[model samples]
Target: MQQDTVLVVGGGPAGLAAAANVNSAGYKAVVVEKEDVLGGAPILSGYAKLVPSGEWAKDAIGRMVKRVEDDANSTVHKGAKVEKLEGEAGNFTATLTNGESVQAGAVVLATGFTHFDSINKPEWGFGTYEDVLTTTQMEQMVASGKIACPSDGRVPERVCILLCVGSRDRQIGREWCSKICCTVSANLAMEIKEISPETDVFIYYMDIRTFGLYEDKFYWKSQEEFKTKFVKARIAEVTASGDGRLLVKGEDTLVKRPIVIPFDIVVHAIGMDPNADNPEISQVFGVGLEKHGFLERAEQYTNTCGTTRKGIYSCGAAYGPETIDDSIAQGAAAGGRAVADLHALVQKAG
Candidate 1:
């Protein structure tokens, strides 16, 4: 007989939420995480404050981790992965890397996304300059309560944030927008200004996309209250000046003029990429990958979280780039759906 359990792959926000929901639905949840610890990118990457909520990542995602771990119906296997999946629908056998096997009624894949590496675009000066940093690195600095240049440890008088790094660029074949970069950058600008009141923050963007409610809270607030400068431009390259400052070469699209500006430090608002383990995941789980390489949903309208294979579901960044709040909600939806479907299958068999 198959166990009344759901196997949740990954230990990120989505996976944890899914497991918690499954446990609440009176079913067991077996979470398999490759990392030694949980919390996924937010904790692993050391994210500072979250968007909209402004809560520290550790505090917010930590609660999700705790909720699942503390539950009696939840079994967590850290530093392990699902090596192979067999059977189908309400009776699936998953062999873990640690030589354990779980007979789960359903499966939920929440293997999150990978942050775009700036080194892929050499002209951005990320690997080339000590002062140039990605948003993740900059976030660590903000968390440390200081916005100083990594090169000389000096408080930068001027800082430039270049948006759309590794996103919406046909040259790199990453055409989809990362979704959260705009709001995050805007919020980061305010945080930088708050920490270093004397520092002037400039955001260079092709388009400012603080969509929906974020328009007023982040974009406009950063400009109106925090006095952050928004520039309509496309950066060409970044080079070091003789004086050790960085020179950003770009065109001011508003004025249709070429410009080069010097800044003490430059930041790249990096985009999200598909998880690096996607190829291996697809092969192991027998799930089809969408055109962009994210797990393919069975059908968008009827089954929002259903994966290509039956009895398997996917949510969060595994489907595409997603916010943490949305990922958690989707995880719950997927978990509830899987449990409901499992019940229906059992009733049919009986």
Candidate 2:
């Protein structure tokens, strides 16, 4: 009965979507992002092209940003982290590190995910070999134009793609599937073939998990049309050659023999992690985390975004693995749910 303000935290695709709805419904809502700019991981992501559906993510997020910018009711704060969050349902206050505070009746936490640094997986020879690179590094390089091997400065004669480096592995903390890696790697392989048909491309994966839709088609196309080679195996190690080439050692599990493949460049399709500050976010908002470290929602169907805490909700990778499209969807859903709760409070006040 006091006030109705909903705070949306994070400015990624999901956060942006959530903010749009929160503003449209005439709720006093603000979006708080820790970065200097609004967009979360995708903004800094080096992906050459968007994933699954292959929509340029920058362009997609650009449209979402414009919506937030045009809506006068929506307030966006860049370069700020919620240092403290307090209060209960229909009343919460977020204290920012920059000495600013945002009061709200509800809070939507959309803090996104972070990439696993390739260097952490030393067995991939990421740091030791100049030719070895992470998928992010490859995207950045491809974006820069000439896609040449870092080792020899030549159009790579052969390229090797390793999947599930940080993802789907129990050795690393991330045991669950990151979901997007296989498609992205396959797309990059195709792009490499398109650019230089002469160069050989090999993808070593334990299982080629093309889950649905056009992605499955793309996987098939890579095999039939592009002639991209696939090896169903788990890589053992990557050793560097004196002249900057890389030797990838893995067992072709299907064949039951050790296979050593050499290449001018080696790319590690690294997985994702909860945003580095996930624990901090959990502490600040008083939300619980899943065993896998994502936000644990109160209920799957009824409260897609609402947390165990009364006034706080979570969306996007803060909750778990999601595609750009799903993140946007979840964001919008969270926004509507929070606004509905706040609106009910407003109605009672009236």
Candidate 3:
């Protein structure tokens, strides 16, 4: 017999939104999360204030987790993953790693993207120097209410944020932009200034893509109000200075000259990469992956969230680098689509 349930993989913002929507539609939602907690990168990485909304990741994503957990129709499996999927649309059985089997009419893959590892680009001084950190690491520092250097307890007088650490670089083979890195870096700059007013923040970038509403909100506001410096430059490498400070070597494209700047701290605005488990997810769910290793969408226009498999849908960063708000919206849409399909199947059976 077909079940009135939707199986949602991953427990990030997108997965929570999908489960909540499904439960609201009077259908059961089985959420399978590999981690013990419901929240994804934001909670796992300990993010501070999110972009656009400016809400704390815990509060924003916490509400989503609460919504899903409160519903009686929703069943969440923590520290478990869907090991195998059998059967077909409207009659699917998913075996979990935790020894649970869920029967569902549809599935929604909301597995999010992974943060680009800064270790791959060692010249940037991530693993080499404790003062050099990723955006996520900086966010953790901001959340902790401290902006001191990891190497030493001293507060940094100058911090340089290098944009597109693992993005738009043919050498790394990550040609796609990570979408939110620019705006996020701008927001981070403002936050750093707010915390430590005396510290000057410089952002080195190829292009400032604040894009649409974020231009005035994050990029322009950061420069005008917070005095965050925006430099059009290509960073070559980050090395140690004679005096123990970090030297950022790069070319100022605007002036057409190479320059080496010294900074107390260097921040790498890392990009988003395809989920590490995309291969396993593709194999278990019988779905296809696009060239970038993200879950392939069946059709962009007609089936916005549908995967290669008929009863399985996908949304959020699983498709590509997506914003949290967009991911939630896509998750809700995918949930609605799955519910509608299930309803149609029920009608046909009747």
lDDT of each: 0.93, 0.82, 0.94
How many backbone collisions does model 1 have? 0
Q: After superposition, how far is residue 206 of candidate 1 from its true place, in Å?
A: 0.9
Model number with the top lDDT: 3
Model 2, runs deviating above 4 Å: 1-3
**Candidate 3, TM-score vs. the true structure?**
0.99
| Candidates in order: C-alpha RMSD to true structure | 0.9, 1.7, 0.8
Ranking by lDDT: 3, 1, 2
TM-score of each: 0.98, 0.95, 0.99
* lDDT (Cα, tens digit) per residue for candidate 3, span 213-292: 99999999999999999999969999998788999999999999999999999999999999999999999999999998
lDDT tens readout by residue for model 1, 124-149: 89999999999999999999999999
Candidate 1, which segments miss by more than 4 Å at Cα? 1-3
Cα shift from native, residue 111, model 3 (Å): 0.5
- Provide the lDDT at 93 for model 3: 95
